[model samples]
Target: MKLTVLGYLGGYPSHGGGTSSYLLESNGFKLLIDFGSGALLSLEKVTDPLTIDAMILTHYHNDHIADVGVMQYYWQLHAERPKEAVLPIYGHREDIQHFDSLEWSGATQKVAYKPEEKLNLGPYQITFMKTHHPVTAYALRILEIKTGKILVFTADSAYFDGLIDICQDADLLITDTNFFANKVGQKWHMTTFETGRLASQANVKRLLLSHLPEIADQDRLVQETIQALNKPIQVQTAKTRLAIEI
Candidate 1:
């Protein structure tokens, strides 16, 4: 399986940056994780929108779901045929309004899932775990059944022990490190320090930082996180076209 960073920022994009969105593809099957602000622009550059097999949402924040409407528009206007246009969207029941609204528009179909249920999408096996966030949020664990490789994504969350267990030795961990350590509070997101600490404890092979806020110097933030880590771990700032193998 391969992971691609389509958009990496949160809240709103940083200066011209995009909000939370990612694309994953394996064995000719494609899936979109989140379609946030600026996602459509970035997506159009990478691949045909119609090729997306399905989409999933971790939460209902506008920063996360902002592009869902436009995606529907793309299908409605550009689809070569009508029957293949509806993209299946999997979101929790907690965000009933977002699902209902999209389903009613005929742009996407609502697929229901529960915590800890393993969903089979071709060779990809996905599982969800509820996370600590202001709204209903979930963390994803997607495993390629044939390769036995797993990728974990903490869509958005505050510091919590459950995240540590969910990330255990994952091939790659995508985390929301939205603020600097000293400046962050646990009300919504985790600081980069806690982000690094989780990677250290979970023994993740690589750490990909996402949901970033504007910083004067990104390298400084990287250094700060490295210092707090118990052991050296590979760290990369999420960026468009950046791809990782699972």
Candidate 2:
């Protein structure tokens, strides 16, 4: 099993085209986390564009869903005909409707898979927990059933109670650390210190931080977060094009 960091940022780049998207591959089954701004460009760097099985939207944010049209068109133009029959897109009901209206230049089918409370997708037994965000955001706990890899992706949320339990024992806790410690309350995103505390309390095996807003100082945030948390949790910033075997 492996997790590839495609575009690793909370917001769009100044020059554009960096992936906030992520791809998870296990036993040749591929699933995408969120399709942020640079999704198509990043996916092309990893595997054949047609091999993508499905996409899971964390929320309705543009940075997370902007590339949906582009990807659909790519698959329609390329890929074998049989593989392009239809694509399963899993997300909240609102998110599904939002993207379906797009005029994608693709001769493919779009299938929407709503949570309907919770459901199992292949090896992933997933449950969408409530999160603190302006929109209807969800915290996803994906269990890689065969290897017992527990991953928690708290898609773009402000810190909230019970978050520790939601992320407890996670093999990898991919939290949204969109700002520095003192930069809390600037918006709905979590501060660095807050993310560190959550990872420590959750006892995650490894903590990979992402969704970084460009205006903060990365060095100071890492140092301060390490000191505040005081745990051996592997806290590190995510980089684009980096792949980690989980």
Candidate 3:
């Protein structure tokens, strides 16, 4: 399984970056995890937008789904689009208005994913866990069926005990590290220290700090996470176009 960082900055994009978006591929099947601000332009640098097999969203937050409208426009008007192409956009049904927007004419289809059920899409088997966020966001655990590799993404959340179990033994854990270590008692996103604690307790092989703060010194965020870790583990900050194989 291969994972590519299309965009990683949290909240609003800055410094030529975009907010939370990733591409996961296995056996030529491309699965787009989110379509945040600036994501379409970044995605074009790697592959054709029309080539994306499917898309999934963790919640309806603007930073997470900002480019979804533009993506629909691309599928609707792109000259090279296939005649019968319809992209399946998987999203939770908690927000009916945003979920309805997932479908755009014949270009896209809205598919509701229940947190209680497991979903099989192409080469991956996915399970969802509701996250501790202001909105009804979900964390995803994707398992590559053929390779037995697991990739977990904590879309957006505050630290919660359940997360440790959901993320346990993952080959890669992409966490929502939207705040620095000093910021605490917030409910929207995880801090650098909290992220490191989760990764260490879960015993994930590798940790990728994503959904990053735009203005903070990114290197310091990584260093803080490393210092907070209970044991040694591979840690890296998410950057556009950064690709990793699991």
Full ranking by TM-score: 3, 1, 2
- The lDDT per prediction is 0.85, 0.77, 0.93
Q: Global CA lDDT of candidate 1, please? A: 0.85
TM-score of each: 0.95, 0.90, 0.98
Relative to the true structure, candidate 1 has a C-alpha RMSD (angstroms) of 1.5
Superposed Cα RMSD, model 3: 0.9
| Angstrom error at residue 77, model 2 | 1.6
Best by TM-score: 3
The digit string of per-residue lDDT tens for model 3 on 185-212 reads 6458899999999999999999999998
Ten-residue region with minimum lDDT total, candidate 3:
179-188
Q: How would you encode candidate 2's per-residue C-alpha lDDT over 81-173 as one tens digit per residue?
A: 575355666767665467564334444344454554566776677777878888888888888889888888988899986789889989998
Per-residue C-alpha lDDT of model 1 across residues 1-246, encoded as one tens digit per residue: 999888888798776778899999999888999899888888888888888999888988989989988887887776474764678888888767776755734567888777668889767998888888889999998888989898999989998988998889889999998878787334588888989999999999999988888653578668767877898899878876688887
Model 3 scores a TM of: 0.98
Off by over 4 Å in 2: 15-19, 102-116, 184-186
Off by over 4 Å in 1: 82-85, 104-106, 184-186
